[model samples]
Target: MHGHQIRRAAQVDRTELWSDVKPGSLYGALHRMQVEGVIEAVRTEQEGNRPARTIYALTSAGAAELIDHRDEALRDTKLRHDPVDLALQNVIDLGEDALRAIIVARRKALAEQLDAWLALRELAAPHIRGLEWTTFRHTELRLRTELAWHDELLDQLPKLMANQPTSMTTS
Candidate 1:
């Protein structure tokens, strides 16, 4: 597919699968893949006044690499690092107000995201099935877990803020 088509597919239905891909960097990624021989430019086509576009096709090596990547992602269970953990550890220094503000903001954002996913699930329930449905379910579960964790943090905020460090030392 052409770069624009690929980007459109990534965006369709708010799939939440391409969180790491920046739209502007896609063409660059395609270029890099072409250089690496993972994908090749099949042809260029232009019609009327539209600019020429290059269509790319994946090679056998690319198919193998893609499968490897998909398998690794599916099998890998280790949790990725979240900066919020580091911030929470040192949150005592920020005072209670800042911590509350940050947590509140995060909760709001998470709630908004959850709402969007829930809406999508509702809308797509009749048409989606199998692996696609499973992906949606997985994302919904993660978001719910995050929301619960944030609520727990809020419940413990008073205790956490009250027990601030009394001294600091470096060795």
Candidate 2:
């Protein structure tokens, strides 16, 4: 249910969803979850004489498992690399002006993400109560922290780009 809700809310496809889970492992995990009674196949519908598509929904047990998994993930210390990091890694190829443009683009994207997170937070607030509020609070804090980090990185880009070697010259 967690995966389905997330995918639906985010409007992303299965291929994109697989990126969040371990590579080459999502199908097996989904199958296991179904077998374990955590998730169940809700329905199947055929499309224009093609094979039927199966839609799954989370059972109560699945929701519990999702919460447990989320808690464990939040506790993990491993640093995850996002697309901005990947772009930064290859910045030299783009030159300073282009790199700055990329940073600007990233800032714009972060702003959009922050707005979406805020809306999601608001939507979640009414449903959450007592200690459950703590989870939403944590999510908001993390989003704020990431936005701040993005701003800081944007501020530092000019100086960093200036320090980068422009070219090699020989006489």
Number of the top lDDT candidate: 1
Steric clash pairs (candidate 2): 1-58
Q: lDDT tens string, model 1, 1-171? A: 898888887777453463566788889989999999999999998879999999999999999998998798889989889998976776545878888899999999999999998998898889896788888889999999999999999999988788877444424
Model 1 ranges off by over 4 Å: 13-19, 167-171
Lowest lDDT block of 10, candidate 2: 10-19
- Please estimate how well model 2 matches the true structure, expressed as its whole-model Cα lDDT: 0.69
* True-structure lDDT of candidate 1: 0.85
Measured with C-alpha atoms, the lDDT of residue 46 in candidate 2 is 69
RMSD per model, one decimal: 2.1, 6.9
Q: Estimate each model's TM-score.
A: 0.90, 0.55
- What's the true lDDT of residue 119 in model 1? 94
Task: In angstroms, give how far residue 18 of model 1 lies from its true place.
Answer: 5.3
